[model samples]
Target: MASEPPDAAAASRRDGGRPGGLRRMLRRLTASEAEIEAEELQRDVERHGCQPARQVERGQLVSVTGRLRTVVYTPRTTVPTLEADLYDGSDVVTLVWLGRRQIAGIEPGRALTARGRVAIRDDRKVIYNPYYELEAAP
Candidate 1:
């Protein structure tokens, strides 16, 4: 197969940035259902004080599932966080975006299954963290 033009890959990324179609596929292939579920249990994971990894030391490494709410990509800034609204028949959870390395596409209300540990951030329950980190995207 012919290799893509040198600029071809760069062009696609330039067109959609890092959070493009490719990112979404990677997230889908990596995230787990339990991870998403654990995310739903967060207590305002967005807040810096929630501290998922620190507070929830014994978080279970589960496979969670959820739906994307939004994805903001800023190459000039730092890692992209994939904001999402995750749910599990039991309840609806607001999943905060993870680091850029783990984040992927911005599905915006799309379903996802993530794999990670249960933790807390700013007094809230979270799936991913440095210690018991949560892999929301990929």
Candidate 2:
């Protein structure tokens, strides 16, 4: 029989009708983790300050050196493609080698420098058939 106050109704709507305290705290914690991860990524990219991957522009010929974070092979497609995600502290770039299943020495945890013109594919930055040099393990 009692009616909710105007402010309580507004707060409930803002919190999606859930109690705000714990839910808000959890949301804040999740956001903090994302912020920390992004900061770490930026710092890693900055270590290679000479050729920062974040500054690479579309269609610009660039030489970026970074550690391979992931290596994926897509053989189901008409053209087999080897895709690798390279991270240089600052940004992540996807490297795609079409018509190839694998390239020797191109694997996760490998350090490599790739030279190519930057392109955007599927809303992600990518380089196709880049000339790459595998770095000596440190």
Candidate 3:
């Protein structure tokens, strides 16, 4: 079999042998802090063998690991709810605990792994009363 020419080999090495290598590099260079953080979180999710939030189907039991983007307590006439948005880079899954104000260790920027059945409300993914484990602050 014929081998690659000298120029071809050099170019392949320079670009890591992939056409989109340069594009990916450029994207990484220009990515915002949040984007970079999301990418890192995604990698961590994969490393820990947890399901991604974006791929979770409604009604399916899943365990997703991510950082909490926001935590809010909403008070209603009948009950109160604590909600947090868990972002795993690909998507956000809201965790809602009904009749709760807040829980210790559940706050913004904290890492967590939550397991529950997925549900959709008002066109967003939510898990109600999920069993969650808070990760140590990094």
Which structure is stronger by lDDT: 1 or 3?
A: 3
Residue runs of model 2 more than 4 Å from their true location after superposition:
1-50
How does candidate 1 fare on TM-score? 0.36
Q: Provide the overall lDDT of each model, using Cα atoms, as 2-decimal numbers.
A: 0.47, 0.81, 0.92
| Candidate 2 global TM-score | 0.64
lDDT of 2 by residue, 23-133 (tens): 664566677754665555565455644367878889988888777999999986478899999887678889999999999999998888888989998878899999998
lDDT of 3: 0.92
Worst lDDT window (10 residues) for model 2?
41-50
Q: Which stretches of candidate 1 lie over 4 Å from their true place?
A: 1-58, 70-83, 92-98, 101-104, 129-138
Tens-digit lDDT string for candidate 3 (32-81): 98898889999989987899988998999999999999999999889899
Q: Considering every candidate listed, which one attains the maximal TM-score?
A: 3
The digit string of per-residue lDDT tens for model 1 on 87-125 reads 443343335545643443435655555555655566544
Q: In candidate 3, residue 1 scores what lDDT?
A: 95
Q: What is the TM-score of each candidate against the true structure?
A: 0.36, 0.64, 0.79
Worst 10 residues of 3 by lDDT: 19-28
